[model samples]
Target chain A: TQTVSQSDAHVTVFEGDSVELRCNYSYGGSIYLSWYIQHHGHGLQFLLKYYSGNPVVQGVNGFEAEFSKSDSSFHLRKASVHWSDSAVYFCAVSARAGNYKYVFGAGTRLKVIA
Target chain B: AQTIHQWPVAEIKAVGSPLSLGCTIKGKSSPNLYWYWQATGGTLQQLFYSITVGQVESVVQLNLSASRPKDDQFILSTEKLLLSHSGFYLCAWTRTGEGTLYFGAGTRLSVL
Candidate 1:
């Protein structure tokens, strides 16, 4: 079974400040990791995904995430956030093969204040 | 461009009432469909997934059932609504050999 964990339930940051949303996962075999952002009252939007090769993947809106095998982590980061970035971020994981059932984290609510 | 649409943007129902939510995909065929539920301020939970017509698999049982009568349509229904069933319902789809899921706008259901 694959599981994802996002330790922080909420994080507040000032506009133009860099932010990092932490995510960690536990799975036995090859896995696919991805991030999604959901604004209030809206469905989630896919940000980025990592399967192989690049440890760091860039996403839309200047967001990026780095995958670390040793830490079993895939943390999303943005050098400078805008107030519009205020939303909930989710980290998801799935097995590379088999059922490919996607498992999502609890999510971290990010508040980018001006 | 592919589009996924969910019906009845929002719904309010009483307990013991039957409920049905619908989702349709356009510009795509034979796509894998999934239903997800999220409580207020809670994480998303996968309810069911269908890779083909008439073959729905349940991931978590919440007294809810799903069906895919047509290749492009997925339906989520329950015989009776429960307070626990009140939440946001989202439908998503992905092509074979693809990892990304495209989601619908979702339906907000309130059970009294």
Candidate 2:
């Protein structure tokens, strides 16, 4: 079984400040890692995903994530955050096998203050 | 382009009452469907997944069941609802062997 962990439950930062949300995973084989953002009372929107080829993958809204094999981590980063960037961020993992199950983390609630 | 639609944007049902939620995918054929339940302000828990018509697999036993009666439709239901069953229900679909998922607007259920 694959598991994802987001150590921080909540993160607060001033608008235009750089931020990084940590995500770590534990799985035996090839896996897919992705990040999603959920605004209050809304469904999650895909941010970015990492499977192969590149260690750093860019996502929408100037968001990006870097995958680290030795660290077993896939952390999301943004150069500067806007007030609109505040939302709950989730880290998900899925094995490359045919099974279509994705394991999601507890999520990190980001609060961007202007 | 593929679009996923979920019925009953919001529901308020009493405990022990039977409940049903529906999802339909348009413009996508043979997509994998999944049902996820999430408590307010909490993480998501995958309940069921279906890869084809008339085939559904349960990931966690939350006293809920799902069915794909048609290629484009997926249904989530339970004989009896519990207070704990009240949460956000999300229906998502992905292309075969693809990892990214497209989620519907979701149904917010409140079981009193």
Candidate 3:
């Protein structure tokens, strides 16, 4: 079974400040990792994904994440955040052995204050 | 370009009511389709997936069932709705072997 954990339930930061949302996973075999953002009352939008190449993957809206095999982690980062960046971020993992079903982490709610 | 659309933008019903939600993908043929449910403030859970017409796989048993009637159409239905069934339901699709998923606006269901 694959499980994803997001240690932070909520994170608050000021506009123009950099922020990183943490995500960790436990899987035995090869897996795919991705990040998504959901605004209030909206469906999730894909941010980025990591599979085999490049430890670091860049996504839309100036977002990027680094995959660490040693840490079992894929953490999302932004150089600077805007007030519009306030949203719920989700980390999801899909095992190649488990088909297309993805196991998602309890999301981290980000609040950017202007 | 491809687009996904879910019908009945929002629904409110009483428990024990029959429910049906529909999704259609345009400009994309033979794409993999999926149904996902999310409770308020919770992560999205995969409920069902269909790779082809008349071939649907259940990922989680939530007392709901899904069917693919056409290559581009997917339907989710339940004979009886439960209070716990109230949540946001999303329809998504991607190419086979591609992990990127594109989602629709989603249907918000509220069971009283």
Candidate 4:
């Protein structure tokens, strides 16, 4: 079965510092990777997605992710964190394009301290 | 722009009581609709999906049934509420070429 793993249960970073949220997947087919952000008491918001062409995909709010086929991973990175960036980040994987039925990770909650 | 709407932003019900949750989709024709349940501090678990009007598919939902009564409406119903069923229920929709899911505000279900 397809599965996604997010090792970090929680992470803390100070404003103006760089941060990385890791995600790994174990799937046999071509995978479509995505990242979502959820604030407390609200629905999830799509951050970014990556498929065939580019290994690096940019998302809203200055977020970006890199897909490494060799590592079977997609990790999110930000050069400078802002206090508003504090939220729970979830990594998801889909088997095919437009299928959207995804296997999500447990999520990594980031606390950005100002 | 496409949008999804879910009713009863929050619901509080007693055990053995009937329950229903509604969702409506807009700006897309023959869109794929989905219902998902998320436990507190847990990831989302898909419950049901509807690919077309009047057709619905179940994923791992327990003691719940889903129906697509119209082209843009999906309904989730249960005969009796369970305390374990309390959590966040989300409604989502997507198109064949859209990899992203447009979600509703979500309904917080609290069963006693």
Q: Which stretches of candidate 2 lie over 4 Å from their true place?
A: none
Positional deviation of residue B79's Cα in model 4 after best superposition, in angstroms: 0.8
Clashes in candidate 1: how many?
Answer: 0
| lDDT digits (tens) for residues A6-85 of candidate 1 | 99999999999999999999997988899999998888899999999989999999999999999999999999999999
Between prediction 3 and prediction 4, the one with superior lDDT is 3
What would the per-residue lDDT of candidate 3 be over residues B27-104, giving only the tens digit for each residue? 999999999999999989999998889999999969999999999999999999999999999999988777888889
Cα-based TM-score, every candidate: 0.99, 0.99, 0.98, 0.96
lDDT of 4 by residue, A16-97 (tens): 9999999999987877789999898888888999988989999998889999999999999999999999999999887774
Q: Check candidate 2 and list the clashing pairs.
A: none
lDDT of 1: 0.94
lDDT accuracy of residue A108 in candidate 1: 100
Q: Predict model 2's lDDT versus the native.
A: 0.95
Candidate 3 wrong stretches, greater than 4 Å: none
Give one clash count per candidate, in the order shown: 0, 0, 0, 0
Against the true structure, candidate 3 has what lDDT? 0.94
- List the global CA lDDT of all models: 0.94, 0.95, 0.94, 0.89
Q: What's the residue-level lDDT of A108 in candidate 2?
A: 100
Model 2: how far residue A7 lies from native, Å? 0.3
Worst 10 residues of 3 chain B by lDDT: B94-103
Which structure among the candidates has the greatest DockQ? Answer: 2
